[model samples]
Target: MESFPHSSACDLTAEIGDYQQFPNPGAEHAATERTPKPKLRHVRVVLLSFGLLCVLQGILNVALRLAVREPTDAGGTEQSCPQGWLMFGSSCYYISSQRRSWDASRQDCVQRDADLVVINSTQEQAFLTGFTMAAWVGMTDREEEGTWIWVDGTRVDKDRLQWARGQPDGAFGGEDCGDLRTMIDFIGLNDFMCSARNQWICEKTFW
Candidate 1:
Protein backbone atom coordinates (compact mmCIF):
# COMPACT_ATOMS: atom_id res chain seq x y z
CA MET A 1 0.00 0.00 0.00
CA GLU A 2 1.41 3.54 -0.90
CA SER A 3 0.71 6.40 1.60
CA PHE A 4 0.63 10.12 0.75
CA PRO A 5 3.25 12.34 2.46
CA HIS A 6 1.66 15.01 4.75
CA SER A 7 2.96 18.63 4.71
CA SER A 8 0.95 19.89 7.74
CA ALA A 9 -0.75 18.58 10.85
CA CYS A 10 -4.14 19.57 9.41
CA ASP A 11 -3.53 17.42 6.29
CA LEU A 12 -4.79 13.89 6.24
CA THR A 13 -6.62 14.30 9.53
CA ALA A 14 -8.66 11.27 8.58
CA GLU A 15 -7.99 8.52 6.06
CA ILE A 16 -9.96 5.48 4.96
CA GLY A 17 -8.40 3.18 2.36
CA ASP A 18 -7.50 5.53 -0.56
CA TYR A 19 -9.74 8.37 0.70
CA GLN A 20 -8.21 11.34 2.65
CA GLN A 21 -9.78 14.24 4.60
CA PHE A 22 -7.98 17.67 5.21
CA PRO A 23 -9.61 19.69 8.01
CA ASN A 24 -7.78 22.96 7.24
CA PRO A 25 -4.81 23.36 4.97
CA GLY A 26 -4.26 27.08 5.79
CA ALA A 27 -4.89 26.82 9.58
CA GLU A 28 -1.18 26.74 10.51
CA HIS A 29 -0.38 29.95 8.55
CA ALA A 30 -3.50 31.73 9.86
CA ALA A 31 -2.59 30.95 13.49
CA THR A 32 0.95 32.40 13.00
CA GLU A 33 -0.31 35.59 11.20
CA ARG A 34 -3.03 36.37 13.80
CA THR A 35 -0.57 37.66 16.43
CA PRO A 36 1.37 40.98 16.10
CA LYS A 37 4.99 40.53 15.13
CA PRO A 38 7.58 41.36 17.87
CA LYS A 39 9.68 43.70 15.64
CA LEU A 40 6.63 45.65 14.39
CA ARG A 41 5.21 45.95 17.93
CA HIS A 42 8.52 47.25 19.27
CA VAL A 43 8.85 49.82 16.45
CA ARG A 44 5.35 51.17 17.10
CA VAL A 45 6.03 51.50 20.80
CA VAL A 46 9.32 53.33 20.16
CA LEU A 47 7.69 55.79 17.74
CA LEU A 48 4.87 56.58 20.20
CA SER A 49 7.31 57.15 23.07
CA PHE A 50 9.49 59.46 20.94
CA GLY A 51 6.49 61.53 19.90
CA LEU A 52 5.45 61.99 23.54
CA LEU A 53 8.95 63.07 24.52
CA CYS A 54 9.08 65.67 21.75
CA VAL A 55 5.74 67.14 22.81
CA LEU A 56 6.90 67.32 26.42
CA GLN A 57 10.12 69.10 25.43
CA GLY A 58 8.23 71.73 23.44
CA ILE A 59 5.94 72.45 26.39
CA LEU A 60 8.90 72.73 28.76
CA ASN A 61 10.70 75.22 26.51
CA VAL A 62 7.62 77.43 26.28
CA ALA A 63 7.13 77.35 30.04
CA LEU A 64 10.71 78.31 30.66
CA ARG A 65 10.46 81.29 28.29
CA LEU A 66 7.25 82.59 29.92
CA ALA A 67 8.12 81.98 33.57
CA VAL A 68 10.28 84.99 34.43
CA ARG A 69 9.87 88.01 32.21
CA GLU A 70 10.97 90.69 34.62
CA PRO A 71 14.32 90.68 36.34
CA THR A 72 14.40 89.94 40.06
CA ASP A 73 16.01 92.19 42.63
CA ALA A 74 18.71 89.63 43.29
CA GLY A 75 19.89 88.92 39.73
CA GLY A 76 18.87 87.76 36.27
CA THR A 77 19.79 85.16 33.68
CA GLU A 78 21.37 85.70 30.23
CA GLN A 79 18.02 85.06 28.53
CA SER A 80 16.94 88.61 29.37
CA CYS A 81 18.87 89.99 26.39
CA PRO A 82 17.39 90.04 22.91
CA GLN A 83 19.06 88.66 19.83
CA GLY A 84 22.43 90.36 19.03
CA TRP A 85 22.40 92.22 22.37
CA LEU A 86 24.91 91.74 25.16
CA MET A 87 23.88 90.91 28.74
CA PHE A 88 25.56 92.38 31.81
CA GLY A 89 24.29 92.69 35.34
CA SER A 90 20.50 93.20 34.99
CA SER A 91 20.62 95.08 31.71
CA CYS A 92 21.14 94.49 27.99
CA TYR A 93 23.52 96.57 25.90
CA TYR A 94 23.76 97.41 22.19
CA ILE A 95 26.99 98.77 20.81
CA SER A 96 26.69 100.81 17.65
CA SER A 97 29.01 100.36 14.71
CA GLN A 98 28.21 103.66 12.97
CA ARG A 99 29.11 107.17 14.11
CA ARG A 100 26.55 109.81 14.95
CA SER A 101 26.20 112.99 16.98
CA TRP A 102 25.04 112.82 20.55
CA ASP A 103 21.43 113.73 19.74
CA ALA A 104 21.30 111.44 16.71
CA SER A 105 22.83 108.59 18.70
CA ARG A 106 20.24 109.03 21.41
CA GLN A 107 17.54 109.08 18.74
CA ASP A 108 18.78 105.81 17.32
CA CYS A 109 18.72 104.28 20.78
CA VAL A 110 15.22 105.64 21.36
CA GLN A 111 14.08 103.96 18.17
CA ARG A 112 15.49 100.71 19.54
CA ASP A 113 13.47 101.16 22.75
CA ALA A 114 16.64 101.95 24.65
CA ASP A 115 18.85 104.91 25.54
CA LEU A 116 22.51 105.83 25.72
CA VAL A 117 24.24 103.59 28.24
CA VAL A 118 24.42 105.17 31.68
CA ILE A 119 27.60 104.08 33.42
CA ASN A 120 26.20 103.12 36.81
CA SER A 121 29.26 101.45 38.30
CA THR A 122 32.98 101.22 37.91
CA GLN A 123 32.59 97.63 36.87
CA GLU A 124 30.09 98.59 34.17
CA GLN A 125 32.35 101.40 33.01
CA ALA A 126 35.23 98.96 32.88
CA PHE A 127 33.15 96.53 30.84
CA LEU A 128 32.32 99.26 28.36
CA THR A 129 35.77 100.78 28.34
CA GLY A 130 38.31 99.61 25.75
CA PHE A 131 35.40 98.28 23.68
CA THR A 132 35.39 101.48 21.65
CA MET A 133 37.94 104.17 20.90
CA ALA A 134 35.35 106.88 21.49
CA ALA A 135 31.65 106.48 22.12
CA TRP A 136 28.92 108.86 23.33
CA VAL A 137 27.51 108.03 26.75
CA GLY A 138 24.32 109.15 28.54
CA MET A 139 25.91 111.96 30.53
CA THR A 140 26.11 115.66 29.62
CA ASP A 141 26.17 119.18 31.06
CA ARG A 142 24.20 120.75 28.23
CA GLU A 143 21.41 121.89 30.55
CA GLU A 144 23.70 123.55 33.10
CA GLU A 145 27.39 124.13 32.54
CA GLY A 146 29.64 122.26 34.97
CA THR A 147 26.64 120.32 36.31
CA TRP A 148 26.74 117.04 34.43
CA ILE A 149 23.73 114.78 34.61
CA TRP A 150 22.57 111.54 33.10
CA VAL A 151 19.72 111.29 30.60
CA ASP A 152 17.64 109.62 33.34
CA GLY A 153 17.99 112.87 35.40
CA THR A 154 20.56 111.41 37.79
CA ARG A 155 23.46 113.65 38.79
CA VAL A 156 26.80 112.48 37.44
CA ASP A 157 29.19 111.97 40.35
CA LYS A 158 32.46 113.32 39.04
CA ASP A 159 34.28 111.63 41.92
CA ARG A 160 32.59 108.24 41.41
CA LEU A 161 33.66 108.00 37.77
CA GLN A 162 37.13 108.29 36.23
CA TRP A 163 37.72 111.09 33.75
CA ALA A 164 40.57 111.90 31.41
CA ARG A 165 43.23 114.36 32.56
CA GLY A 166 41.97 117.94 32.41
CA GLN A 167 38.56 116.81 31.10
CA PRO A 168 35.45 118.96 30.95
CA ASP A 169 37.69 121.89 30.30
CA GLY A 170 34.96 123.43 28.12
CA ALA A 171 37.50 123.20 25.27
CA PHE A 172 36.88 125.19 22.06
CA GLY A 173 34.15 127.37 23.54
CA GLY A 174 32.21 124.49 25.13
CA GLU A 175 32.21 120.67 25.19
CA ASP A 176 28.94 119.79 26.93
CA CYS A 177 28.15 116.27 25.71
CA GLY A 178 29.75 113.43 27.65
CA ASP A 179 31.61 110.60 25.90
CA LEU A 180 33.96 107.72 26.70
CA ARG A 181 37.29 108.11 24.96
CA THR A 182 40.57 106.22 24.57
CA MET A 183 42.67 108.75 22.65
CA ILE A 184 46.35 109.32 23.36
CA ASP A 185 46.64 110.65 26.95
CA PHE A 186 42.86 111.01 26.81
CA ILE A 187 41.14 107.93 28.29
CA GLY A 188 37.99 107.37 30.37
CA LEU A 189 35.15 109.92 30.33
CA ASN A 190 35.44 113.31 28.59
CA ASP A 191 33.21 116.19 27.64
CA PHE A 192 32.82 116.54 23.89
CA MET A 193 30.80 118.72 21.55
CA CYS A 194 27.21 117.53 21.18
CA SER A 195 27.42 117.78 17.39
CA ALA A 196 30.62 115.75 17.11
CA ARG A 197 30.02 112.39 15.45
CA ASN A 198 30.98 109.25 17.38
CA GLN A 199 29.93 105.67 18.02
CA TRP A 200 27.70 105.02 21.03
CA ILE A 201 26.39 102.39 23.39
CA CYS A 202 22.71 101.77 24.18
CA GLU A 203 21.28 100.08 27.24
CA LYS A 204 17.93 98.77 28.44
CA THR A 205 17.17 97.12 31.73
CA PHE A 206 15.21 93.88 32.09
CA TRP A 207 13.25 95.25 35.02
Candidate 2:
Protein backbone atom coordinates (compact mmCIF):
# COMPACT_ATOMS: atom_id res chain seq x y z
CA MET A 1 0.00 0.00 0.00
CA GLU A 2 1.06 3.84 -0.78
CA SER A 3 2.46 5.53 2.24
CA PHE A 4 0.76 8.70 3.35
CA PRO A 5 2.68 12.08 2.87
CA HIS A 6 5.16 12.22 5.61
CA SER A 7 4.93 16.07 5.98
CA SER A 8 1.61 17.64 6.74
CA ALA A 9 0.45 21.18 5.51
CA CYS A 10 1.22 22.56 9.00
CA ASP A 11 4.87 21.62 8.61
CA LEU A 12 5.17 23.66 5.33
CA THR A 13 3.69 26.70 7.09
CA ALA A 14 6.33 26.48 9.86
CA GLU A 15 9.18 26.46 7.29
CA ILE A 16 7.84 29.64 5.65
CA GLY A 17 7.64 31.41 9.06
CA ASP A 18 11.29 30.62 9.81
CA TYR A 19 12.42 32.07 6.49
CA GLN A 20 10.63 35.40 7.27
CA GLN A 21 12.73 35.85 10.51
CA PHE A 22 16.08 35.89 8.59
CA PRO A 23 17.90 39.29 8.17
CA ASN A 24 16.76 41.56 5.24
CA PRO A 25 17.62 45.25 4.37
CA GLY A 26 14.68 47.70 4.18
CA ALA A 27 13.81 51.30 3.01
CA GLU A 28 15.40 52.85 6.20
CA HIS A 29 18.89 51.56 5.19
CA ALA A 30 18.56 52.97 1.67
CA ALA A 31 17.58 56.42 3.07
CA THR A 32 20.53 56.55 5.53
CA GLU A 33 23.10 55.78 2.78
CA ARG A 34 21.68 58.38 0.30
CA THR A 35 21.64 61.26 2.88
CA PRO A 36 25.45 61.19 3.51
CA LYS A 37 26.22 61.47 -0.24
CA PRO A 38 24.43 64.85 -0.58
CA LYS A 39 26.07 66.21 2.60
CA LEU A 40 29.55 65.42 1.20
CA ARG A 41 28.68 67.07 -2.12
CA HIS A 42 27.60 70.29 -0.35
CA VAL A 43 30.89 70.45 1.61
CA ARG A 44 32.91 70.13 -1.61
CA VAL A 45 30.95 73.00 -3.27
CA VAL A 46 31.55 75.38 -0.31
CA LEU A 47 35.27 74.67 -0.32
CA LEU A 48 35.55 75.33 -4.06
CA SER A 49 33.67 78.67 -3.78
CA PHE A 50 35.94 79.95 -1.02
CA GLY A 51 39.08 79.10 -2.96
CA LEU A 52 37.80 80.88 -6.09
CA LEU A 53 37.06 84.10 -4.12
CA CYS A 54 40.58 84.25 -2.71
CA VAL A 55 42.13 83.83 -6.14
CA LEU A 56 40.01 86.66 -7.58
CA GLN A 57 41.02 89.04 -4.80
CA GLY A 58 44.71 88.41 -5.41
CA ILE A 59 44.37 89.08 -9.15
CA LEU A 60 42.60 92.41 -8.52
CA ASN A 61 45.32 93.59 -6.14
CA VAL A 62 48.09 92.94 -8.68
CA ALA A 63 46.17 94.65 -11.49
CA LEU A 64 45.56 97.76 -9.41
CA ARG A 65 49.26 98.18 -8.62
CA LEU A 66 50.27 97.81 -12.24
CA ALA A 67 47.67 100.34 -13.50
CA VAL A 68 48.59 103.14 -11.07
CA ARG A 69 50.94 105.98 -12.13
CA GLU A 70 52.99 108.22 -9.82
CA PRO A 71 54.81 111.53 -10.29
CA THR A 72 58.62 111.63 -10.18
CA ASP A 73 58.68 114.20 -7.40
CA ALA A 74 55.67 112.97 -5.59
CA GLY A 75 55.78 113.68 -1.81
CA GLY A 76 58.69 116.12 -2.34
CA THR A 77 58.81 119.74 -1.19
CA GLU A 78 57.76 122.49 -3.62
CA GLN A 79 60.25 125.10 -4.87
CA SER A 80 59.49 128.71 -5.90
CA CYS A 81 61.35 132.03 -6.29
CA PRO A 82 60.93 134.72 -3.66
CA GLN A 83 57.75 136.81 -3.90
CA GLY A 84 57.54 140.23 -5.64
CA TRP A 85 61.21 140.25 -6.76
CA LEU A 86 64.10 138.17 -7.96
CA MET A 87 66.18 136.29 -5.39
CA PHE A 88 69.95 136.38 -5.45
CA GLY A 89 71.38 134.32 -2.62
CA SER A 90 69.88 135.54 0.69
CA SER A 91 68.76 138.96 -0.53
CA CYS A 92 65.86 140.42 -2.53
CA TYR A 93 66.31 143.45 -4.80
CA TYR A 94 63.88 145.77 -6.56
CA ILE A 95 64.91 147.74 -9.62
CA SER A 96 62.65 150.68 -10.17
CA SER A 97 62.13 152.84 -13.24
CA GLN A 98 60.64 155.77 -11.33
CA ARG A 99 63.10 158.49 -10.39
CA ARG A 100 63.05 160.31 -7.06
CA SER A 101 65.26 162.50 -4.90
CA TRP A 102 67.69 160.71 -2.58
CA ASP A 103 65.29 161.32 0.28
CA ALA A 104 62.28 160.34 -1.84
CA SER A 105 63.99 157.16 -2.97
CA ARG A 106 64.55 156.20 0.64
CA GLN A 107 60.89 156.87 1.36
CA ASP A 108 59.83 154.79 -1.59
CA CYS A 109 61.88 151.89 -0.33
CA VAL A 110 60.41 152.27 3.13
CA GLN A 111 56.89 152.24 1.70
CA ARG A 112 57.66 148.99 -0.09
CA ASP A 113 58.89 147.42 3.15
CA ALA A 114 62.48 147.54 2.01
CA ASP A 115 65.57 149.66 2.46
CA LEU A 116 67.60 151.67 0.02
CA VAL A 117 70.57 149.59 -1.16
CA VAL A 118 73.06 149.02 1.65
CA ILE A 119 76.18 147.29 0.36
CA ASN A 120 77.53 145.38 3.35
CA SER A 121 79.91 143.05 1.50
CA THR A 122 82.10 143.03 -1.54
CA GLN A 123 80.03 140.32 -3.12
CA GLU A 124 76.94 142.49 -2.81
CA GLN A 125 78.80 145.51 -4.09
CA ALA A 126 79.94 143.58 -7.12
CA PHE A 127 76.51 142.17 -7.75
CA LEU A 128 74.98 145.61 -7.54
CA THR A 129 77.71 147.15 -9.67
CA GLY A 130 76.52 145.00 -12.53
CA PHE A 131 73.07 146.58 -12.22
CA THR A 132 74.38 150.16 -12.09
CA MET A 133 74.53 152.05 -15.38
CA ALA A 134 72.89 155.31 -14.27
CA ALA A 135 70.79 154.31 -11.25
CA TRP A 136 70.49 156.34 -8.06
CA VAL A 137 71.39 154.20 -5.08
CA GLY A 138 71.13 154.69 -1.32
CA MET A 139 74.44 156.51 -0.85
CA THR A 140 74.11 160.24 -0.40
CA ASP A 141 75.09 163.11 1.89
CA ARG A 142 72.07 165.29 1.20
CA GLU A 143 71.85 166.09 4.91
CA GLU A 144 75.57 167.01 5.05
CA GLU A 145 77.91 166.85 2.12
CA GLY A 146 81.27 165.01 2.56
CA THR A 147 79.64 162.72 5.14
CA TRP A 148 77.81 160.21 2.96
CA ILE A 149 75.40 157.85 4.75
CA TRP A 150 73.13 155.05 3.57
CA VAL A 151 69.38 155.31 3.84
CA ASP A 152 69.49 152.49 6.42
CA GLY A 153 71.74 154.74 8.55
CA THR A 154 74.78 152.47 8.19
CA ARG A 155 78.05 154.25 7.54
CA VAL A 156 79.50 153.42 4.16
CA ASP A 157 82.18 150.79 4.55
CA LYS A 158 85.09 152.84 3.19
CA ASP A 159 87.08 149.72 2.41
CA ARG A 160 84.34 148.32 0.16
CA LEU A 161 83.67 151.68 -1.52
CA GLN A 162 84.85 151.63 -5.17
CA TRP A 163 85.31 155.36 -5.74
CA ALA A 164 86.44 156.39 -9.20
CA ARG A 165 89.95 157.89 -9.60
CA GLY A 166 90.11 160.96 -7.37
CA GLN A 167 86.34 161.17 -7.66
CA PRO A 168 83.58 162.19 -5.26
CA ASP A 169 85.42 165.43 -4.66
CA GLY A 170 82.06 167.15 -4.22
CA ALA A 171 82.08 168.21 -7.85
CA PHE A 172 79.73 171.17 -8.42
CA GLY A 173 79.41 172.63 -4.95
CA GLY A 174 79.70 169.48 -2.85
CA GLU A 175 77.21 167.41 -4.89
CA ASP A 176 75.26 165.35 -2.30
CA CYS A 177 73.35 163.09 -4.83
CA GLY A 178 74.83 159.61 -5.40
CA ASP A 179 74.67 157.76 -8.74
CA LEU A 180 76.23 154.56 -9.92
CA ARG A 181 78.66 155.17 -12.82
CA THR A 182 79.93 152.49 -15.21
CA MET A 183 83.17 152.88 -17.14
CA ILE A 184 85.50 150.58 -19.09
CA ASP A 185 87.40 148.20 -16.80
CA PHE A 186 85.85 149.76 -13.73
CA ILE A 187 82.59 150.32 -11.91
CA GLY A 188 82.68 153.68 -10.16
CA LEU A 189 80.66 156.40 -8.45
CA ASN A 190 79.35 159.73 -9.82
CA ASP A 191 77.75 162.64 -8.07
CA PHE A 192 74.66 163.90 -9.81
CA MET A 193 71.94 166.46 -9.24
CA CYS A 194 69.28 164.71 -7.08
CA SER A 195 66.49 166.06 -9.31
CA ALA A 196 67.90 164.18 -12.35
CA ARG A 197 65.64 161.38 -13.56
CA ASN A 198 67.15 157.89 -13.13
CA GLN A 199 66.20 154.40 -12.02
CA TRP A 200 66.89 153.32 -8.44
CA ILE A 201 67.83 150.12 -6.63
CA CYS A 202 66.17 148.96 -3.43
CA GLU A 203 67.09 145.99 -1.29
CA LYS A 204 65.52 144.02 1.53
CA THR A 205 67.02 141.40 3.80
CA PHE A 206 65.59 137.90 3.71
CA TRP A 207 65.94 135.98 6.93
Candidate 3:
Protein backbone atom coordinates (compact mmCIF):
# COMPACT_ATOMS: atom_id res chain seq x y z
CA MET A 1 0.00 0.00 0.00
CA GLU A 2 1.09 3.66 -0.73
CA SER A 3 2.42 5.50 2.39
CA PHE A 4 -0.15 7.85 4.04
CA PRO A 5 0.49 11.67 4.03
CA HIS A 6 2.70 12.83 7.02
CA SER A 7 0.33 15.63 8.06
CA SER A 8 -2.71 13.31 8.03
CA ALA A 9 -0.92 10.67 10.11
CA CYS A 10 0.13 13.30 12.64
CA ASP A 11 -3.45 14.57 12.88
CA LEU A 12 -4.82 11.04 13.42
CA THR A 13 -2.31 10.38 16.25
CA ALA A 14 -3.20 13.67 17.99
CA GLU A 15 -6.93 12.89 17.82
CA ILE A 16 -6.45 9.37 19.25
CA GLY A 17 -4.30 10.80 22.09
CA ASP A 18 -6.91 13.43 22.94
CA TYR A 19 -9.73 10.83 23.00
CA GLN A 20 -7.75 8.54 25.27
CA GLN A 21 -6.74 11.36 27.65
CA PHE A 22 -10.25 12.87 27.98
CA PRO A 23 -13.11 10.53 27.11
CA ASN A 24 -15.91 12.45 28.95
CA PRO A 25 -15.16 16.19 28.59
CA GLY A 26 -18.88 17.08 28.61
CA ALA A 27 -19.56 15.36 31.91
CA GLU A 28 -16.45 16.82 33.56
CA HIS A 29 -17.29 20.36 32.38
CA ALA A 30 -20.91 20.01 33.61
CA ALA A 31 -19.76 18.98 37.07
CA THR A 32 -17.26 21.88 37.31
CA GLU A 33 -19.60 24.66 35.96
CA ARG A 34 -22.76 23.78 37.98
CA THR A 35 -23.30 24.35 41.75
CA PRO A 36 -23.97 21.44 44.10
CA LYS A 37 -27.73 20.84 43.84
CA PRO A 38 -28.04 18.85 47.09
CA LYS A 39 -26.31 21.55 49.22
CA LEU A 40 -28.42 24.35 47.73
CA ARG A 41 -31.62 22.37 48.30
CA HIS A 42 -30.67 21.74 51.93
CA VAL A 43 -29.97 25.46 52.58
CA ARG A 44 -33.33 26.42 51.05
CA VAL A 45 -35.14 23.90 53.21
CA VAL A 46 -33.44 25.20 56.40
CA LEU A 47 -34.34 28.83 55.63
CA LEU A 48 -37.98 27.92 54.93
CA SER A 49 -38.20 25.93 58.19
CA PHE A 50 -36.85 28.86 60.26
CA GLY A 51 -39.27 31.32 58.66
CA LEU A 52 -42.23 29.02 59.33
CA LEU A 53 -41.22 28.62 62.99
CA CYS A 54 -41.07 32.41 63.50
CA VAL A 55 -44.51 32.89 61.95
CA LEU A 56 -46.02 30.18 64.15
CA GLN A 57 -44.55 31.78 67.29
CA GLY A 58 -46.04 35.15 66.43
CA ILE A 59 -49.46 33.65 65.84
CA LEU A 60 -49.31 31.79 69.14
CA ASN A 61 -48.50 35.01 71.03
CA VAL A 62 -51.53 36.80 69.56
CA ALA A 63 -53.80 33.91 70.39
CA LEU A 64 -52.61 33.81 73.99
CA ARG A 65 -53.19 37.55 74.47
CA LEU A 66 -56.72 37.28 73.12
CA ALA A 67 -57.50 34.32 75.32
CA VAL A 68 -56.25 35.95 78.53
CA ARG A 69 -57.52 39.48 77.99
CA GLU A 70 -59.82 41.02 80.65
CA PRO A 71 -63.03 42.82 79.82
CA THR A 72 -63.54 46.49 80.67
CA ASP A 73 -66.42 47.59 82.89
CA ALA A 74 -69.35 49.83 81.84
CA GLY A 75 -67.37 52.95 82.73
CA GLY A 76 -64.49 51.71 80.58
CA THR A 77 -62.52 51.11 83.77
CA GLU A 78 -61.09 47.86 85.08
CA GLN A 79 -60.70 46.75 88.69
CA SER A 80 -57.07 47.22 89.54
CA CYS A 81 -56.54 45.50 92.89
CA PRO A 82 -57.54 42.05 94.04
CA GLN A 83 -59.90 41.43 96.97
CA GLY A 84 -59.10 42.47 100.62
CA TRP A 85 -57.81 45.97 99.82
CA LEU A 86 -60.47 48.59 100.64
CA MET A 87 -61.28 50.64 97.55
CA PHE A 88 -62.41 54.24 98.03
CA GLY A 89 -63.47 55.96 94.85
CA SER A 90 -60.26 56.04 92.81
CA SER A 91 -57.93 55.38 95.73
CA CYS A 92 -56.92 52.58 98.10
CA TYR A 93 -56.82 52.64 101.93
CA TYR A 94 -54.74 50.61 104.39
CA ILE A 95 -54.73 51.05 108.16
CA SER A 96 -51.29 50.33 109.58
CA SER A 97 -50.37 48.78 112.92
CA GLN A 98 -50.86 50.82 116.08
CA ARG A 99 -48.18 52.26 118.47
CA ARG A 100 -46.30 54.86 116.41
CA SER A 101 -45.89 58.62 116.77
CA TRP A 102 -47.44 60.90 114.15
CA ASP A 103 -44.11 61.36 112.37
CA ALA A 104 -43.26 57.67 112.68
CA SER A 105 -46.70 56.76 111.40
CA ARG A 106 -46.29 58.99 108.37
CA GLN A 107 -42.90 57.45 107.66
CA ASP A 108 -44.39 53.98 108.03
CA CYS A 109 -47.10 54.83 105.55
CA VAL A 110 -44.50 56.13 103.15
CA GLN A 111 -42.51 52.93 103.53
CA ARG A 112 -45.65 50.94 102.85
CA ASP A 113 -46.15 52.76 99.53
CA ALA A 114 -48.67 55.28 100.76
CA ASP A 115 -49.06 58.60 102.54
CA LEU A 116 -50.92 59.93 105.60
CA VAL A 117 -54.71 60.03 105.15
CA VAL A 118 -56.20 63.00 103.33
CA ILE A 119 -59.92 63.58 103.97
CA ASN A 120 -61.33 65.13 100.80
CA SER A 121 -65.02 65.68 101.57
CA THR A 122 -67.28 65.97 104.58
CA GLN A 123 -68.75 62.57 103.94
CA GLU A 124 -65.30 60.96 103.94
CA GLN A 125 -64.32 62.82 107.05
CA ALA A 126 -67.51 61.78 108.79
CA PHE A 127 -67.13 58.23 107.68
CA LEU A 128 -63.55 57.99 108.99
CA THR A 129 -64.40 59.79 112.23
CA GLY A 130 -67.10 57.24 112.99
CA PHE A 131 -64.57 54.48 113.61
CA THR A 132 -64.99 53.14 117.17
CA MET A 133 -61.38 53.41 118.17
CA ALA A 134 -59.43 56.65 118.20
CA ALA A 135 -56.95 56.11 115.34
CA TRP A 136 -54.54 58.52 113.69
CA VAL A 137 -56.08 60.34 110.69
CA GLY A 138 -53.15 62.29 109.23
CA MET A 139 -53.86 65.72 110.73
CA THR A 140 -51.22 67.46 112.83
CA ASP A 141 -50.26 70.82 114.31
CA ARG A 142 -46.58 69.82 114.59
CA GLU A 143 -45.48 72.58 112.20
CA GLU A 144 -46.92 75.48 114.24
CA GLU A 145 -48.35 76.07 117.69
CA GLY A 146 -52.00 76.03 116.63
CA THR A 147 -52.09 76.12 112.83
CA TRP A 148 -53.35 72.60 112.01
CA ILE A 149 -52.46 70.94 108.71
CA TRP A 150 -52.81 67.51 107.15
CA VAL A 151 -49.77 65.36 106.54
CA ASP A 152 -50.08 66.16 102.84
CA GLY A 153 -49.84 69.89 103.60
CA THR A 154 -53.58 70.53 103.02
CA ARG A 155 -55.16 73.19 105.26
CA VAL A 156 -57.88 72.01 107.59
CA ASP A 157 -61.37 72.45 106.20
CA LYS A 158 -63.14 73.61 109.30
CA ASP A 159 -66.51 72.48 108.00
CA ARG A 160 -65.32 68.95 107.31
CA LEU A 161 -63.79 68.50 110.76
CA GLN A 162 -66.18 67.07 113.37
CA TRP A 163 -64.37 67.97 116.58
CA ALA A 164 -65.45 66.20 119.74
CA ARG A 165 -66.64 68.31 122.69
CA GLY A 166 -63.86 70.47 124.19
CA GLN A 167 -61.45 69.35 121.48
CA PRO A 168 -58.26 71.14 120.25
CA ASP A 169 -58.33 72.53 123.73
CA GLY A 170 -54.53 72.62 123.81
CA ALA A 171 -54.99 70.63 127.03
CA PHE A 172 -51.68 69.69 128.65
CA GLY A 173 -50.01 71.35 125.63
CA GLY A 174 -51.59 68.58 123.52
CA GLU A 175 -52.74 70.78 120.60
CA ASP A 176 -49.48 70.18 118.70
CA CYS A 177 -50.61 66.64 117.72
CA GLY A 178 -53.84 65.64 116.00
CA ASP A 179 -55.69 62.38 116.54
CA LEU A 180 -59.06 60.87 115.83
CA ARG A 181 -60.67 61.00 119.28
CA THR A 182 -63.88 58.99 119.64
CA MET A 183 -66.17 60.08 122.45
CA ILE A 184 -68.98 58.06 124.00
CA ASP A 185 -71.19 59.07 121.06
CA PHE A 186 -68.53 57.77 118.62
CA ILE A 187 -67.77 61.24 117.21
CA GLY A 188 -64.19 62.15 116.20
CA LEU A 189 -61.94 65.15 116.84
CA ASN A 190 -58.44 66.41 116.09
CA ASP A 191 -57.26 65.79 119.63
CA PHE A 192 -54.48 63.81 121.37
CA MET A 193 -50.72 64.23 121.72
CA CYS A 194 -48.15 63.92 118.91
CA SER A 195 -46.12 61.56 121.13
CA ALA A 196 -49.12 59.24 121.60
CA ARG A 197 -48.80 55.98 119.63
CA ASN A 198 -51.82 54.88 117.62
CA GLN A 199 -52.75 52.97 114.49
CA TRP A 200 -52.78 55.15 111.37
CA ILE A 201 -54.73 55.08 108.15
CA CYS A 202 -52.76 55.34 104.93
CA GLU A 203 -54.19 56.68 101.68
CA LYS A 204 -52.68 55.98 98.30
CA THR A 205 -53.62 57.49 94.97
CA PHE A 206 -54.09 54.97 92.23
CA TRP A 207 -54.88 55.18 88.57
The numbered model that scores best in lDDT is 1
lDDT per residue as tens, model 3, 61-139 = 9999886554545788764543434556666677655578877888887887788788778667666664436667777
RMSD of 3: 14.4
lDDT, candidate 3, at 140: 76
Candidate 1's C-alpha runs over 4 A off are 1-78
User: Which structure is stronger by TM-score: 1 or 2?
Assistant: 1
lDDT of 2 by residue, 86-113 (tens): 5555567887777777667877878988
Residue 118 C-alpha lDDT in model 1: 93
TM-score against native, each model: 0.63, 0.54, 0.57
Q: What order do candidates take by lDDT, descending? A: 1, 3, 2
lDDT of 1 by residue, 1-207 (tens): 999965986674765586677768598678768987899899999999999999999999999877755455654443467787887788899989999999999999999999999998888988888878999999989888999999999999889888989987999899999999887888899999999999999999866
Runs off by more than 4 Å, candidate 3: 1-77, 81-84
In candidate 2, position 85 carries an lDDT of 63
Q: How many backbone clashes does candidate 1 have?
A: 0
lDDT (CA) per prediction: 0.89, 0.71, 0.72
RMSD of candidates 1 onward, in order: 10.5, 18.4, 14.4
